[model samples]
Target: MEKNAPCTTVCPTKALKQDEVTRVVTHSTDLCIGCWACSMVCNYGVIGRQKEARVAVKCDLCPGREIPACVEACPTNALVFLEVKKLSGVKRTEAALKLARGMQGKAL
Candidate 1:
């Protein structure tokens, strides 16, 4: 079982639930009381309270979408969705290349 967040734990109506398969957190509008408990307890501050609906909202990882809208809209290729392991390898390679270039400049 996934760990319960403080936000989810405090939800009175059980409006928020995490999918076991995807680990995606979702809010059920029907069950929500608009109490803002989830929004108040979210550590990342990703939860948003909609003034119109008064219910908390958050990213559900863009379910059913091939690519996230933010990533797709980025023009500079600066934003990327990558696994942590791959990102770590890339960072390590970049650091090594930077160090090698500095050493080469000193040797010149």
Candidate 2:
């Protein structure tokens, strides 16, 4: 788990926890206090409020399913599930390509 993650850090009831084996962050509604701190601190803004339950809600990556429903339902395939390292590598490759294209017009 990211030690500096604001959502997890600010959760007063410790409802958010990262599984050591799966490395998935899990939320325990039973422990949640309806404070919305997790939703407020979520970087991706995926967290939401369960209006009926008065508790915070977020994606659990669709446990027991091979692919998350969101990813499967995206018609344009805009959403992708990838490991952090793989995503970082893809970003780095894109940046390098952009740099190379920009340098093509320069004297150097």
Candidate 3:
């Protein structure tokens, strides 16, 4: 949820997405499957299908950490990270929609 993730809205399963062309990272939640496919393919280890969410998830640019472990480990700087201004209209819309969906209650 960096700021401008396009794939978050586009994903049919609501699984994963990069913030934008520039972010070059991904975000995941409890829907991961632990497939390890994302970790295997991406040069930056930007993907991981964990068991919690039963789906794939990735980088998500560690905000609190002073430095990312992956970035420090990278030999070629393939995963340069950046932060964006929170002036996100699309993000607000999507979050609003998600919140509304939550109010509907969980599926039985």
Candidate 4:
């Protein structure tokens, strides 16, 4: 969650916004015009077009909830919410762990 998100900065309708304190990016369908500007500018591809509604759609941080629905509802704990600054470290750690594990093959 960049302080100045590309999607929010590129949006003509100001539909996408980033919180200065939390650094959480939010998408507002009410203000969205379905212009696809956010979708195009978003590097993560989280923003998408809702063809039926003719508006952009993205996670709004679950509004009143502490955690997003997808993160909370994930049965396999696949999805996780993290601060932007910590994301790189997390990815690095995951890569290191995978590299260390490698291919075990058969244990004869």
Query: What lDDT score belongs to each candidate, Candidate 1 first?
Result: 0.78, 0.83, 0.56, 0.84
Off by over 4 Å in 3: 1-3, 13-26, 32-54, 73-79, 82-108
Model 1 agreement with the true structure over 76-97: per-residue lDDT tens digits: 9886665546877898999999
Tell me the lDDT of model 4 at 85: 61
TM-score of 2: 0.69
Say which candidate scores most in TM-score.
4
Q: Estimate each model's TM-score.
A: 0.63, 0.69, 0.34, 0.80
Question: Candidate 4 has what TM-score?
Answer: 0.80
Candidate 2 C-alpha lDDT tens digits along 4-78? 557877899999887767767788899998999899888768679998898888789999988899999999999
Backbone clash tally (model 3): 13
Q: Rank the candidates by TM-score, best first.
A: 4, 2, 1, 3
- lDDT score at residue 70, model 1, on the 0-100 scale: 82
Residue-level error in angstroms, candidate 4, position 94: 2.0
Q: Write the residue-wise lDDT of candidate 4 on 1-108 in tens digits.
A: 676789989888888888898778888788988889888888888887899999988877787888889999999999988875687799999999897677456454
Show pairs that collide, candidate 1: none
Tell me the spans in candidate 1 whose CA falls farther than 4 Å from its real position. Answer: 76-108
